[model samples]
Target: MIRLVTLQSGIAQGLLWAILTIGVYITYRILDFADLTIEGTFPLGAAVTVVLINSGMNPFLATAVAMLAGPLAGLSTGILNTVFKIPGILSGILSMIALYSVNIRIMSDKATVAIAGNSIKKIVATLFPAGTVSNTLSTTVGIIVCAALIATLYWFFGTETGCAIRATGNNSKMSRSMGINTDMMTIIGLMLSNAIVALSGSLIAQFDYGSALVNMGQGTIVIGLASVIIGEVILIHKEHNFAYRLFSVVFGAIVYRTIISVVLTISGFKATDIKIITAIIVAIALSIPVFKEKAAMRKKRNLAMKEGK
Candidate 1:
């Protein structure tokens, strides 16, 4: 039997991870590049949000600003890769390292902040009219806002600029040959991806009992990639529609979180094992195409043998 509370928590965690999955989607899927900077930027956003909220800023506004910071982080990585001619992987690594100091600064020079005192929930309570209705209203507001943002992203990806971005990812050489500035597209795509990641981190800091630590973003990229892969595994057939494919990342993120929740609920599973499990899952997902190819050949050979008989 499934626990309702655990199920809801898993869904919330999944939604949070969706933001990271989208970020990875931009670099891994869209740009056809590997970017490690996401791991740092996620924590940076959370740190920034925590600091601002503790200082009496509006939690929602703080989270929004935090999201905006993600693009700037991505832009730095893009510049390193494109302008300096650094390898995509190396550029992402350099940017991720540099962001550690920036994240610390964002946290007001603290390694972590305790949010038990000044929290988004407290702010919501004060802002809304007193009673149980207020709590429901706040939760509803957050969910609606997040859902709207996701929907808007879906629509935006269908626009002309978005198409250019996708083209840059699908075929950089061809895109350049057709007069598209592939470099510009790369920068823009990373910016958009990281921005969503930051937004997710900011919201998570608020929702997951407040507070943010310097290492909060560790393993973020892996989690995002796992979500993308898990979603693909579930909706293996929707590869044709770009919109649906993008949305699949979100669903995958949720599913990934749900699985983790179930595992944790079962006794004796160490939470730290999550990273190990995620890596294995991604590896298995990556092998799917290869396995399918081998299976197809075997099937073809069996059919030929039957024909000969």
Candidate 2:
């Protein structure tokens, strides 16, 4: 029974975090840039939402503000990379490091900030008022929100500007030659990506943890990469359409969280080992394609040897 509850909770959390993974995919996969600002923006969003909620703002509005703040972080990284000519990875690292202090300030110099008002789940329960299960409501909300986000992204990416962004990622030199401002595209992509990430963080802080902590986003990059890689592995042979790939990332997040929940239920799993386990999972997922290619080459070699004999 406890395990069942744990699994359900994991699914709910996974759905929320999938938003962040999708955001990561925008920067890492689509933009071909490793922007580590997500680690900072995640906690920054949580801090902003929690502080606003504690100050009597509407929960939904607070979440929106949190998302709005995300773009600023991304913009900073973009400026550092484009204007100052810093390397992509370094720019992200600088932005992430700076956000630590910013997040602490946002939380009023506290390591954590507890929310004071009703959570979204409770608010939904109030609207229903008919023995609405909090877990089920939360999960339902997560699904609806994720689906809406994915649909919106699909539409946006099909636009002219979106195609230019895609072209910038595929070949920056060619995009520039074709009159696409690669720098502007990078900034826009990063802003959009971090906005989604922060939105996820806000939801997580409000619905799951009930507080925003400074260290809440620790090791987030690994988890996001793991989710993306896991999804790609599962969809290795699927059509490379945008909508399908987005859905695959969400599914990957669910699977990753499910695996973690199951591991935690085992007898000898220590809480501190979670990061190590996540690392192993990500490593294995990333190596799958390489292993497959190597196997294929070996098989080809064997067939050639047999023919020669």
Candidate 3:
């Protein structure tokens, strides 16, 4: 029963992170750039949301402010990369590094804040009244919100600007020739991606009944990347429907968390080994294509041997 609860908790955590992974996909996959600002921006959102909620601000409004902050972080990186001619990856690294201090300031140098007694939780308690049932309701509400946001994103990506963003990603030189401002497209793409990321952070802070802490975003990009790769692995031979691909990311995140929960339940491994496990999963996912090629070659060799016999 404890193991089952652990598994459920993992799934819940993963579902929350699925939003961040999808945000990462926008820049990493769609825009073809690394926007490491997500590391700082994610925790920034949480911090801002917690601070506002603690000061008696509206929860929804606080969440909105947090979401807005994420895009601005991306914009800073975008300008650094595009305007100053810095490499995209390097610009993102610089921005992320800068955000470390910014996040510290935002959190008022606290390592962690206990949001368990906050108004957000109180409001939910009032509504649900039941103990575990309130937690369930909060999770359900969050899932619904995430689902709606994902659907809206799917629709937006089908728009003209979104198509241009995709085109710029596929070939910036061609997009330039077509008179689309590739620089602007990059900025817009990063902005949108980080907005989603921050929104995820806000939801996480509120849901977990915790305040944002600096460095909370460590390994976040890797987790997101892992989710994407896991999703791809599952859909390796599946059709290329965009909606399916998007949902697969969410599914992958949940599965990844499920795996972690199972691992954590095993007494042999320390909780700190999560990063090691995450790296292993990512390495395996990345090696899949090479493995597939080797398998094909072996099959061909066997066919030749049969013919010779």
Listed in order, each prediction's TM-score against the native is 0.89, 0.95, 0.93
lDDT tens per residue, model 3, 112-153: 754543545456666774666534654676577668877887
Candidate 3 to native Cα RMSD, angstroms: 2.0
Global lDDT scores for all candidate models: 0.80, 0.90, 0.83
Candidate maximizing lDDT: 2
Clashing pairs in 2: none
Q: Candidate 2, residues 1-309: lDDT per residue as tens digits?
A: 347788787788889889999999999999999899999999999999999988988888888999999999999999999899999999999999999999999999899898888666667777776886556766877898889889999998999999999999999999999999999999999999999999989988877888999998888889999998898888757568899999999988888888888888888999888899999999898888799999999999999999999
lDDT of the structure predicted as candidate 1: 0.80
Lowest lDDT sum, 10 consecutive residues, model 1, at 132-141
Q: Which candidate is the best by TM-score?
A: 2
Report the Cα lDDT for candidate 2: 0.90
Model 3 regions lying over 4 Å from their true place: 116-122, 133-135
How much is the lDDT of residue 196 in candidate 1?
81
